[model samples]
Target chain A: MTRTFKIFAKELRDYFVSPIAYIVICIFLLITGWFFFSTFFIYNQANLRTFFTLLPVVFSFVIPAVTMRLFAEELHSGSYEMLLTLPVKLSDVVVGKFLAGAAFASLMLVPTLSYAVSISFIGDLDWGPVAGGYLGAVLLGAAYSAVGVFASSLTRNQIVAFITGMVICFSLTLFDKIAIFFPAAIVGVFTQIAAGYHFENISKGILDTRDVLYFFSVIFVFLYGAHLVMQEKR
Target chain B: MIHVEKLTKFYGSFCAVDQIDLDVSRGEITGLLGPNGAGKTTTLRMLTGYLAPTSGTIRINDLSIDDDALAVKKLIGYLPESAPLYHNMLVYDYLDYVAGIRGMQSRRKAERIHELADLCGLSGIMHKTVGELSKGLKQRVGLAHAMMEDPQILILDEPTSGLDPNQIVEIRDIIRRIGREKTVILSTHILSEAEAACDRIVIIDKGRIAADGSTESLKQGSGGEHTIHLSLLGADFEEASRAIGAIDGVSRVERVEGANVDELRLRIFAGGPDRLREKIYACVKATDWIMVELTQEGKSLEKIFRDLTREV
Candidate 1:
């Protein structure tokens, strides 16, 4: 466990020391802020429904950009051999990198909280759903972060990893919308597998065990996929 | 102590390391010498637990790598070719990160880093990012990283490759210094490097152990094929080749290329005993040719290496 933390600390420090973390956060905030305020007065509903609605789409792109270099850079640099030859296990490497990506993805949500604080001052804002929205955002970020890490492990090119991660996350976000094209029997299955659907449930102050379980399962499946990819590399 | 038995590796259908057995005792600097693409790196990779062997077992201090990989890894420090490190990390941070991963305490990590900085001459570049440093300096940082935990075994693949002469000497000095108490295994194609730094040389070729012995023993074991260089002032290549080729136990006589145009040089491949030189001198004395130089060349490691690795 300590070994895993050491790798986590090193990866996190790498994110901060390089310009990648800052650049990714800047782009994430700009897109989220622009989309949220542009539609804010149009609704004038005292709630952050527009921001929550666009969060998954924005995160689908932003989280992959944040996690693209996790495994790809190491593999490209040949530092992966050095890292693996050390007294560390494959689980330690996978989990440590996953946590670092998850942590950075969640950190991207910190600046958006001002949207909630500012909304409360202007109108009578219900803090319940706003707080729940933040919780759902974190879970959604982590789930996508896992997907990003897995994608990064599959290739040595960072651009390829980014595109692959984005494609997977984008499909998950758009699954429910595409469910309308399918038959009624499978439409329910598509909706159940859609990440945006579960994220919407948590954002609306409905803390369903099923929704939380869905996000956890996504995180688990992708993280385990990353572990399997790394194992195949060995 | 390290023991390897019938270790082999196959990348797809191509075998990189064949079934080879080796045993390394403590406090011995063993040099894995071979020509390029001779499976030296693949063997080192398997021994360091970077690549899983197809069919064999590795035991270090009674711990099998398959059963206790982390435990075996803790005892070994490996430096891959060219020292591929994180190019964006500062020297200090990289060392500290390595020390942290090695499970050193905070205070001890600081002390060890300081010691390695001075030992590897890295104090001047502690603040510099690794990518900005030159190859020699980067290699020094790699040395410090490999020695971060002071493991019992050090496996270096082409440690001094692509360095200037002075940097090669410096790195070899550090390697020799560390080899006094620890088991050091370094691979190189340069024979002089193995001759200088290693107590035992294991020559590998075609994924097999071609020869294994000390430097002197390897030279002695190489078949006695010595060359005698003869420079004559009044002689021609044809006459020298005919006269020397007729002698018993003289395998071949060839003209030697010489910078001095005034003298004709001939090299006699004497496969006979040590007294072949006297017989050659007698034959030259019988003639009126002036012998400017007549010297026998000693058996070199390069010759033995070529003889072993050359294809039939």
Candidate 2:
């Protein structure tokens, strides 16, 4: 467990030392800030519904960029050989890199909290859904981060990892929105598999057990998939 | 102590390492010498537990690599070829990270990092990023990384491949100092490196061990055939060959090429070692030809290596 944290700390430090982390964060804040404020006056709404709704779409692309280099860089540089030969388990490496990606994705959301605070001063902002929205955002980011790590493990090219991760995240976010094309009888299954549907339930302040369980399941399935892919490398 | 039995690895249909059995006792520097694609790197990877073998087993200090891989990893420190490290990390940060992963206490970790920096001549470059350093500096940093825990066994794959002569000598001195108390195994294609630094040399050809011995023993054991070169003025090849070929111990006589028109150069391949040089000198003294050069050359390590690994 301690070794896992060591890898996690090292990986996170690796991210901050490069310009990529700052650039990604600035772009994320720019896109989200522009989209949410573009329509805040028309709705005259006190709640942050527009901001929370666009979170999944904005994260679909941003989270993959953050996680793409976690495994791909190590493999391409041949540092994976040096890393694995250490006195640490493969699980430690998998979990460590996953946490680093998830943590960085979570950190990107910290700056967006000013949006909620600014809106609170202008109008009556209900704190319940605001709290739930932030919770659901974190869970969603973690799930996408897991998918991105799994994609990164499949190849040594960072660009390929990013594209593959973006494709998977885009499909998960678009599943419920595209369910109208499916037959009526199986529409429920598509909705259940979609990440946006559960995130919507949490952002509405419903706090359903099923929604939380869905996010946890996504995190587990993708992390386990990443673990399997890494094991096959040996 | 390390023992390996029938260690074989196959990449699809091609075998990279074939049924290699080896043993290394304590405080021994064993050099794995081979040509390119002779499975030296593959063997080192398997020994370090980075790659699982296709067949066979490895035992280090009575612990099986298959059953106790983490335990074995704790005992061995491995430096892969070219020293692939995090390019963005500073030298101090990289060594610190390795020490953290190796389970060194924070206080001791700082102390050990400084010690290794001094030992590997890395104290001056501790603030520099790894990517900006020269190849020799990066290799020294890698040595410090591998020696962070003072492991019982050290494995290096082509440790001095891309360094200048001075850097190569410095690294060799470091390795020799470490080999005094630990078990050291290094692989190299440079024949002189193996002869200079190793206590035992194991030559591999086409995924198999062709010869294993000390440098002197290998030179003496490989046929013991020495050559005598004779450069004569005012003597033709025919005359020199007739005079030197009649000696009892001389096996064959051939004229060396590219001599002056009036000079005759003859090479005599002699064996059996019955004072053949004195007899040749006496015959030269008796003849009217002026002997310009007469020298005997012993079998060299390069000759033995070529004889063993030459393609059929």
Candidate 3:
């Protein structure tokens, strides 16, 4: 566990040293901030429900960009050889990189707390849904980044990683809706696996174990897949 | 100390490393000499636990590589070829990250980083990003990375593959210095590199050991044959080669080209260690030839390597 944290720290520091982290943070804030204000002008509501809605689309792009270089560049640069030879488990490297991407996503969401603050000043506001929306934001980030890390592990090209991550996340985000076109029996099954279904349940200002576990499951499955890919290299 | 028994690795149906056995004692620099695609890297990778062998037992001081992998890995410091590193990181930051992973306390890590900085001659460029440094500096940083934990065994894969002559000398000097305390296993295709640095040499060809011994012993073992080089001025290349081949002790004669056009240099391979100078001089006296140079050449390590691995 401690070794995992050490790798986590190194990857986080790598993001800061390179321009990727800054560019990712900038793009994330820019698109989300534009959507929040544009929605606030038309609805004039104290709630940030629409603001939370725009985030999935923004994160679908930002999260992949953040995680694209994680494993892909390591493999391409041959640093995977160096990392594996260390006295650390493959799980450590996978979890460490996953946490780094999730942490960056959470940090990228920190500035958007101003949306909650500004909404509070404008009119009567319910803190429950606003706080729940941010919690949901983090959960969504963790899930998206997991898929991103897994996609990055599948190839050595960052562009391929990014595109693959986008496709997977988009499918997961819209699968349940697309399933409406399928037979009624399988619709429930697709609804259960779609990320939007769980994000919707959490965005309702409730702390439900089912919704939290759903997100955790998504994070686990992808991270475990990434771990298997790394082991195959060994 | 390390013991490997019948280590084998196959990529699908193709055998990259056949069943092979080796023993390495403490404090000896052993070089795995082989041409490319000869399973040198594959062998080292399995030993370091970077790649799992298809079938084998690798025991380091009685602990198998599979059972106690983390423990075995802790005892090994490997520097892969090309020295892959995080180019975005400063030299100090990268070393610090490596130290952190090794579980060193921060204060001790700082002190040890400084020690490695001095040892690797990386004092001045510690703050520079790794991407900005030259190939030599990157290799030095990689050396420092592998030495961070001060492991008992050091594995280097082609440590001086891409360096100029001067850089090669510097890296080889560091390897020699490190070999005094740690058991080192380095792989190289450069024949002279193995001859110059290794205490023992294991020449691998086509995934098997072709020869294993110290430089002197290999020379002596293959040195049973003698070579007599004669530079003749008045003899034709074909006539001199045929005449030398006809000598009693001479097994084969090769005309050494790339010399002065008017002169022909003949390297005659003899059957035994006996001096072929007199026989060659007699043969020359029987012919209308001027013997400008006649010197008995000792068998070099290059010759020994060729003799051992030529068929492979």
TM of each candidate vs. truth:
0.92, 0.93, 0.90
Which regions in candidate 1 have their CA more than 4 angstroms from the true location?
B229-266, B275-295
Candidate 1 lDDT by residue in tens digits, A1-234: 888999988888889988988988998889889998998998888999899999999999999998999999999988998888889998899899999998998888888889988989999999999889989999999999999999999999999999999999999999998998999999999999999999999999999999999999999999999998887766
Q: What tens-digit string does per-residue lDDT give for candidate 2 at B103-211?
A: 9899999999999988999989999999999999999998998898999999999999999999999999999999999999999999999988999999998889999
Return the TM-score for candidate 3, rounded to 2 decimals.
0.90
- Give the candidate number with the greatest DockQ: 2
Better of 1 and 3 by DockQ: 1
State the iRMSD of every prediction, in order shown: 0.9, 0.7, 0.8
| Deviation from native of the Cα of residue B189 in model 1, angstroms | 2.3
Arrange candidates by TM-score, descending. 2, 1, 3
Candidate lDDT values, in order: 0.92, 0.93, 0.90
In model 2, which residue pairs have backbone atoms overlapping below 3 Å?
none
What are the per-residue Cα lDDT tens digits for candidate 2 across A1-234? 889999999888878989989999999999999999999899989888999999999999999999999899999999999999999998899899989998998899999899889989999999999999999999999999999999999999999999999999999998999999999999999999999999999999889999999989999999999999988776
CAPRI class assigned to model 3: medium
DockQ of 2: 0.81
Model 3 lDDT per residue over B168-259, tens place: 99999999999999999999999999999999999998999988988888777775777778899878988888888887878888989855
Off by over 4 Å in 2: B229-243, B254-266, B272-296
Q: Please provide TM-scores computed only on chain A for all of the candidate models, following their numbering.
A: 0.98, 0.98, 0.97
Instruction: Rank by lDDT, highest first.
Output: 2, 1, 3
